[model samples]
Target: MSARQPHELLLAARPVEILGVALSPVEYSGVRVMTLTMIDQVHKRPDGTARRNFNEHRARLVMGEDFFELNQPNEIRALGFSRPQGGTPAAVLLLTEAGYSMLVKSFTDDLAWDVQRLLVKSYFAKPAPATDPLASLPPEQRALIALMVDNASIKAEQAAQSQALAAQAEVQAEQGAAITAVGQRVGDLADTMLMLARPAGAESIVHIRERINKLHGLPSRIIDEVLRQSPIAPKPAGMVKHSREEARGGSYAVYWIKDVSAVFARFSGECTRITATQVTHPYIDGRFKLLPARDRP
Candidate 1:
């Protein structure tokens, strides 16, 4: 047969077991590196039963050197194997009887050549197109296109910035309103506390209850803050309802506090104790009833 081409030779050697596959860059030039492991096995029948045993073989292969050059230590050395200085240079390693048999049985020249060709094809393919078809316009046209894109980008960025600012402003306004509302409610709660702390003879539970009832109409934050500063325990679990006569002489407003004590206790145990201005009535004889606070008229 005629001598194989360079590519064909590379392909044939592709599957050859290299002793030390240089996983990293090496000091030598024009030398491709690879590391591989070898396994040996024996099959036998033990007492009429089939069995197999395995052994491991390891070696490094240094290619591309003449038979006499391979023995040189400086030429190819990776792992434990190295070429002796100024010895018979050979491209192929001299394997022992077992090693030779194993390699011969495990790999074929055709498979090695085929794999090498595939590796060459994969690594040395044609370059890809750098730009899309639409991007390859005349110089003036491209400049105009780029300018348009820049302007659109600027406009989108400006709109987004404006929207973020507006949202931030709106949030700030809501926060300011909530703060003011909470301050007013806190003032009202202070008044109620003062009334409750009055002398026993002058104490008016009705008035205190009325003041607390007004808190129901306040914003949730104010209500929470008032409760935070009051001495009353948190509302108990389950549903709670309070019916109160309006301070302005209107119909009674019915309010519900779900898990009132639990919610109150979340912010309890501070210098300022929060008490509920209302009470819940239990179901009596399978019927629900509304009972006013003892302080209520």
Candidate 2:
């Protein structure tokens, strides 16, 4: 190798600044600025106005990589009007992350409470779906309080709907029971009319229906429903025949009554076995095959 040149070692050292400007009495946000060095230069305009310039005043009104936190006086002062070191920048006023949060984020009344809750929490956070796992993991700074609030609101709505449905079901069950009871009362009225009154003694069907409703203390709704829907409700016209008597003068739309004895006697031409439970039934077993005098032979 050739011998090293006399200036070979100088190439490795940082270059020294031999040039700069100077100015003073400078103020920033009410604070007096002091520079490391100041030099004076004067220029006389053609109009005879002299403008003196500072070689480095505007070059670095403010500069540094370190952020000047506006909220904290100490951090702001920490910037200290010094030149940048290493790769750090110069002449910049830093806007802190917290500063942007207060300035940019806004909430209306509906979401205000959720934001309040979120502010109190120190360390729970979720990330955006599109964010990378590497960026999200070990989260030193992030939160998903808004999403949680949305979920809680949805659950509250669902619970309210479920309660409403349950109440509707209860009302429907009560209505069904009332209809069944009204039907039973109307059935009893039919059997009584069948056994005790012949056409000559019977009243008008409409009149009899009102009497039965009043006698049973049935509500108007129940009364109307019974007349409309009950199988045993006396119709506006007709008659039902029975053993030994063909009664007329009321709708025969009466519900079935099990009086095997009555039914047997009517069909068989006999007046025996009148003690059978009065319900609607063809027969319990083939024993009913013995019914009717003519069929037996």
Task: Give the number of the best model, judged by TM-score.
Answer: 1
Query: What TM-score does each of the candidates earn?
Result: 0.33, 0.23
- The reply for model 2, stretches above 4 Å from the true place, is 1-143, 196-241, 244-297
How far out, in Å, is residue 9 in model 1?
24
Enumerate residue pairs that collide in model 2: 21-55, 21-56, 22-54, 22-55, 62-91, 63-90, 63-91, 232-255, 258-278, 258-279
**C-alpha positional error of residue 211 in candidate 1 after TM-score superposition, expressed in Å:** 33
Supply the TM-score for candidate 1.
0.33
Worst 10 residues of 1 by lDDT: 42-51
Q: Count the backbone clashes (under 3 Å) in each candidate.
A: 32, 10
lDDT of 2 by residue, 133-196 (tens): 4465454332455567788999999999999999999999999999999999998877665543
